[model samples]
Target: MHLFSLTCTDFAAALHQGWGKGMFHAAAIYRHVFKQGNPDLAQVPELAQAGILTQELQSAFNVSSPAIAAMAVQEGVTKIVFSLAGGLRVEAVWIPMPRRTTLCLSSQAGCRMGCAFCRTGALGLLRNLAAEEIVGQVYAVRHGLGRAIDNIVFMGMGEPLDNFDNVAQAIRVLSDQRGLDIPHSHMTISTAGLTDGIRRLGELGWPGLNLAVSLNAADDELRSQLMPVNAIHPLAQLKQALQDYPLRKKGVFFIEYVLLKGVNDSRGHAARLACFLEGLPVRVNVIGCNPGPDCLFESPGEEHCRLFCAWLAGEGLFVRMRSSRGQDINAACGQLGGPAH
Candidate 1:
């Protein structure tokens, strides 16, 4: 359910709305209303109104409990995985080319980015998901495939940086030696460049945890228009913050630039972008813009895309064109879950 309009006390009041008797009674009402039988510490009343028995549902959806969500964990060039979303919808996909089995996990119900080209961000923001729910996605995937997921990407539904604490907590829980035990290095967190959150991540000193910044545009003006967060954070400060980001063993942050035809794709624009990252240790992963409904931006021509990468490479920056995998399913970078199935 969407909690945007629900205040803490409002949530409390909902639980207390018709709370009469045992937890199951409240659970029944919450299930009927929210359609999710999960309870959180939003407030006792909200707990009551929501009628969620968190512990109960956690036990119920445990993939390891049933030994499902996994067919096998053997080595493979490519492994199929699902992009789990809120109860509303989900995306099933495969990992990197040739050989891979990694699932991208969504830590929230919906997104608030409202990026014109993105499906999930356009859905507006939903409530932040708890660590269990984040990990629960893995469980669902495991059960679906009856095999273990090798790696994970936090580049799914919502902005992971928006749900920093829960995202970090989920990583800890999933990496628990006794539990899923996926290391920090194996998981990745992609963002639309949340400077504050990125700074916070630097303090943890977790080596090998990959990061991808959704920098669809090269300059500030276009970036702010395409990504609202750019207005508040700004590209200058973001670039500096990224430079300060502690990278383990010369790690390079992935600068994901989605190319569009008329916008941010001209040779002049490419040269300007090359100047933007003169000495940064970064890799440009040029992604093809997946045309979405209501998006005015068109994908750049193949030649222009190549030239853009070439320009950046001439400036001594590592640049590469990202292969369009699952494009038919709209599974390219920054494309994932949404409201409408």
Candidate 2:
């Protein structure tokens, strides 16, 4: 593993004691590797002059490639399939907005949370990506685009919380001031209702980090049917976890509700959802299901999505409807699964 694979603190600890260069060198190296995506460490003047960048460090630590095997773009939403070490493939989506460009990254090769609507879940969990692999996705996309990315969401191919340790390190790497320097508030981790993960995040005390829970169904029975993870950590337990979550006073967590036509989009379901999230500080993001060839679900009509948002708002819940961006290229939510060639 190279220095690129390690966290900032871990990289600092690995420096030679005799060099006495300290964190100044580590920060400079990180800036070159992460912020600039410098492929060759010897190109960096600070590392080169110190004589510490020896053949040993070169052999032990190497820069990870984003390994973009394939790419598809539609209406400015670009999805790139990244090949990891060992032939495992993951995805990252780049969405360019007027204000900020956002990259949705995957923490695992595939997903274990078998949400009925998601194509990635159908593959099962392949393996957890290393912290460097996670960082490599950002480096690859940004390097390819020749642009800066302002936001990141772990909502591409896996449940981020399931790969917590690696994901956490990646977050630190991305937000490090001498590195990518993305604000904590700009990075969001979306999970498939993992209460343990939620509790663990709370314990970490990173209050500014945003958490989005996929609560596709309001009722326990319906939710369990839609998302199998609900059976292990049901709605009640999830609610308790959110209740105990130490959110910042101004922070509002996201509630992602994927609307499956006639399944979880009924007016009654909306009311039940309102009751379920009664006193929580949340903003419900209503996503119309992005249909895939193998999936049985379908998205509700535009009017129905509007009504769902209206109904949630009627119950005094803050709600917004987000349309699927890249359906033609299979880059939309629930449609990110295929052989990574």
Candidate 3:
């Protein structure tokens, strides 16, 4: 019922139905909601006088902060706690870099994927966030940052593909020019190898949106042990899905490999990963595991991480070892759903 969550087209329809106003109100409403303007119908005498702001519509349409419960800032990253209407709380992280600011959104309250190293999996599946809730996170973050975000990642506290519809709708809304005005290329959806969702996204032919697969382990057996979702959709099926996906010009898919200490950080594992991505146009991002008390997995040392990236680079693969950010605030990768502010 949140008006801030609706797409421009849908909001226009609602305006026409409620107040007899046509598409003329779409742009104004979009600006009101996304541009941080007042959305009160009482403030606009025309809509109130025309009976466009009906009691039912007024009750249903709200453009306020109902989802945010708490917020904390650490380093350059800001962590927000969003309390859904269903009584479940989820976390979102805002990461600010020198060049660009990126916000990480959660698709679900907790998670069902059960990745052994993920803290969110420890909480199990609570519920999938509605489209409005998913988009609402961005709205909340934008207000907090006092500026629009440059990038967004669906890699917060849940498996995004499991909640595909809402996530996709959120993406469309975020990329809409009338709304957040974020480009598709600036958005990324990271998944734990959900082949069905990948196929659906590819079928939609939404070019420019980035895709990142959480392929922590190149081998099926090791992957299954780390992520239970892999057992359902193995590497073979996932690889086929990636191959079938249509990529836009200069679009290179991302392979996100979390280097676990003595686990998936070996030179052999790196070689296997290079072999697995042999023919695909991909850039490998090696992240050292961000350890939390919820998971026993320890992050690989800087030397081990360097060695892994070196091995992949030796195999002629583009590799970057990304350092974990906001560790002090517990806002780094794989640290959500843990005991932190």
- Could you say which candidate leads in TM-score? 2
Off by over 4 Å in 2: 17-20, 339-341
Query: How many pairs in model 3 have backbone atoms within 3 A of each other, for residues 3 or more apart or on separate chains, i.e. clashes?
Result: 1
Which 10-residue span in candidate 1 carries the lowest summed lDDT?
65-74
Cα lDDT, all candidates? 0.65, 0.86, 0.84
Off by over 4 Å in 1: 1-87, 90-92, 338-341
Cα-lDDT of candidate 2: 0.86
Q: Each candidate's root-mean-square deviation in Å?
A: 10.1, 1.6, 1.8
Clashes of 2: 2
Instruction: Write the residue-wise lDDT of candidate 1 on 150-181 in tens digits.
Output: 78888777888899988887776566543455
Stretches > 4 Å off in candidate 3: 44-51, 54-57, 144-147
Q: What are the per-residue Cα lDDT tens digits for candidate 2 across 1-341?
A: 65546766677777645455678777777878877777667777887778774565667678767678898888888889987778788988898888999999988888999999999999999999888888888888887557569999999999999999989988888888777788889999999989999999888889989999999998889999999999999999999999999999978889999999999999899999999999899999999998878889888888999999999999999999998888888888878877422
Root-mean-square deviation of candidate 3: 1.8
Q: What TM value does model 3 have? A: 0.95
TM-score of each: 0.73, 0.96, 0.95
> Against the true structure, candidate 3 has what lDDT?
0.84
Residue 81 miss distance in model 1 (angstroms) = 11
